[model samples]
Target: MSLIITDECINCDVCEPECPNGAIYQGDEIYEIDPNKCTECVGHFDEPQCQQVCPVDCIPLDPNNVETKEQLMEKFVKLTAKS
Candidate 1:
């Protein structure tokens, strides 16, 4: 599943740099995760890097964009090829 940054985000700007996919961005109010670009760090790390660095623990799996590990890996491959 992709991750979502909730309103609990403190806007500390830590998670943005930690995201390997560059999915995290500063929204109008809080950091937002673009599901299209989020691969849960599948090709980069074992765990979501943003979640690990978010001080407020606002990052959580996005149920709306749920996907299996294989799907995430596929996404990672596709994204990497574009880079």
Candidate 2:
């Protein structure tokens, strides 16, 4: 699954830099995760890097944008190919 930044986000700015897919960005209120670019760090790391550094732990799996590991890996491949 991709990740979502909740209202609990303090905008610490840590999560934005941690996203390998560049999925995290400053939204009107808080940092938002772009599900289309999010691969949960599948091709880059074992775990979602943003979640690891979010001080408030606001980053969580997006139930609405859920995907299997294989699907995430596929996204990762597609994403990397563009870069």
Candidate 3:
């Protein structure tokens, strides 16, 4: 599943740099996660680095866009141009 940053986010900017997919973004005074680019770090890392670094724990699973490992790998390849 992709991850979503809720309104509880303080915009601390801690999770942005930790994301390998670059899915996290500043939302005015909040932070948002792009589901299209969010792979839950399935292809690039063993765990979701953003969630690990998020101080507020705002990052949560995006139930609306659940994806399989193969799908996530395909997305990772497209987003990263994995050779």
TM-score attained by model 3: 0.88
TM-score, structure 1 vs. true: 0.95
Go through the candidates in order and give each one's C-alpha lDDT.
Answer: 0.91, 0.92, 0.87
Per residue, candidate 2 scores C-alpha lDDT tens digits across 1-83 of 89899999998899898888899999999999999999999989998899899888898899999899999999989888955
Tens-digit lDDT track of model 3 for 1-83? 78888888887889998888889888776888899999889877898998899888888888888888888888888998846
RMSD of candidate 2 to the truth, in angstroms, is 1.1
Each model's TM-score? 0.95, 0.96, 0.88
Clashing pairs in 2: none
Please give, for residues 2-73, the per-residue lDDT of candidate 1 as tens digits. 989988888999999999888988899988999999999998998999989887899989989999999999
Give the runs in model 1 whose Cα sits over 4 Å from its true position.
Answer: none
Instruction: After the best TM-score superposition of candidate 2, give how far the Cα of residue 55 lies from its true spot, in angstroms.
Output: 0.6
Show where candidate 2 strays beyond 4 Å.
none
- How much lDDT does candidate 2 score? 0.92
Model 3 lDDT at residue 35: 90
